[model samples]
Target: MASDPFDRPNRNSSSFILVGVPSLETSPICLGILFCSGYIITLVGNGGVLLVIGLDNSLRDPVHCFLGMLAVIDVVMVTTIVPKMLSVFWLNSTQISYMACFVQMFLVHSTTSEESGVLLAMAVDRYVAICHPLRYQAILNRQTIAQIGLAIVVRALLFMDPLTGMVTKLPYCHSHVVPHSYCEHMAIAKLACANPRPSGLYSVAGSSLIVGMDMAFIAVSYGMILKTVLGKKSCWKAFSTCGCHICVILLFYVPGIVSIYAQQFGSGISVHAQVLLADLYLTLPTVLNPIVYSMRTKQIRQAVLKMLFSRKVHA
Candidate 1:
């Protein structure tokens, strides 16, 4: 009877059970509260940013437009995982259909790539604003923003197609229980019946090709900005312009970098710790980007305040 309980769900199972925080599975109430709170906060914070940006024409500048794009990405990125996570805790419903799991995996990675590319685009925008102040208008017009958005979509598609195809080919002969709150690529890959090494290698290669390249570009852009800002006034202005972005970049990248090293290179860490790190890697950026921008950027703060006050007045 015990053996039967542990038997394979089936080699051809049409879905996988996401074992959300198995170590804390006994305390579903606590986990449910925590994840649901994070979900609400993310939706409200990001949604507010988008609303304020839309309402304020003064914020229709290229920078704010890019910020609006980022807000949308954050909302999508968080939506792909958090709601399901909440379900795991609240309803104890963790069974994600096979195709739906892949779609979630695809959306998570694709949106992550888009966010990284968007950050790089924002860095370029700042570089132009600081280094070529006079030509900023001509260079980063509405047409250029549209082109950048289109390019981001194309980049995400190009990267995800091969990776998703490879993952789709994987045979899941082992347990169908994924030991995480979500259907992340690496987590799902770990369950495959065949060798998972190729999937890991492909992920590393994709990261190098996408995130690594974007980081290099951002570094180069910042380096040039530093050189161009020669004097005190210029230095202050340049740094001021980049302050919010730098915080966002660090918040977005640092967790994943640390977690990767900790998981693959570091020794003797528990699985729960690794899962927590992964959660932070994705969740922190989505939750914090809007908060960081609203707090650090005066124009955004003022716009949000104005919108709030206007609503209150109408009420």
Candidate 2:
């Protein structure tokens, strides 16, 4: 039988569970409405991104292909965490079964890692196209893109597997009430009775290695791309083409970096603030990615319009 973490006795029982954090105070009606709205928006936006990329032959190139995979990853990630989280909030239940909690932890971490990998792959794609235009098609062919996507999934699975196992193995002698909204690694680790130094060390080390290497590669790639773009006669046009990608990169990376540091260093930020920021990181990309592609990429916009109008005509 699985032990209940909350039932465990501790000296600082009051502090074991977070105090002063505002409870979910909204009426059930409001909670239901908000949950439905969030789910619908995320689903439609991510679904549209996948549909547009898949159906439009012109958008099947290396860059859009990567973007499409990102859309899929976002959809999977949100589906895994947000709905259940909304349930917890609406029901006002801080308790999650040990197995369910670990499963959620695994899915969230895996998808997040995969998303980071996908972003890094997109950066490499941009680097190849802008910095080495002549070799772009040859290097980033269809098979190569598929291979990169596979690599992202494989890497995420491998990286998160051991961490999930480590987390599930820890004795939960503290309170089960997670400090934050989700089953995040840091939050869960704090509840463990076992010495979490190893887990913390592993998390920081692994995250730093992966994020650092990826960021370095992206930085080098962008540096070369900038040099190449500046050398071009139509530098403005070159910049315009890469602008959307740059926007997406910044949007995805900046919040992630902020959240990681805030969570790690025990910044004095309130639990509510951290939860809101974490939700934003999970959601914004789902909403923004499709909008950015539709507005910025002429091919994607035309494809979306054609699909919408065709559906209307058929109806």
TM-score of each: 0.90, 0.83
Candidate 2: where are CA atoms >4 Å away?
A: 1-38, 231-234, 237-244, 312-315
**C-alpha lDDT (0 to 100) for residue 108 of candidate 1:** 86
lDDT of each: 0.82, 0.73
Clashing pairs in 2: none
| Model 1 spans > 4 angstroms off | 4-9, 234-244, 258-267
108-160 in candidate 2: lDDT tens per residue? 77887888888788778877887788999999998898888889889888888
Error of 1 at 122 (Å): 0.9
Q: Cα lDDT for residue 157, model 2?
A: 83
Instruction: State the TM-score for model 2.
Output: 0.83
For this target, which candidate reaches the highest lDDT against the unseen true structure? 1
Expressed as tens digits, the lDDT of each residue in 56-104 for candidate 1 is 8898888898888888998898899888988888898989999999999
Best by TM-score: 1
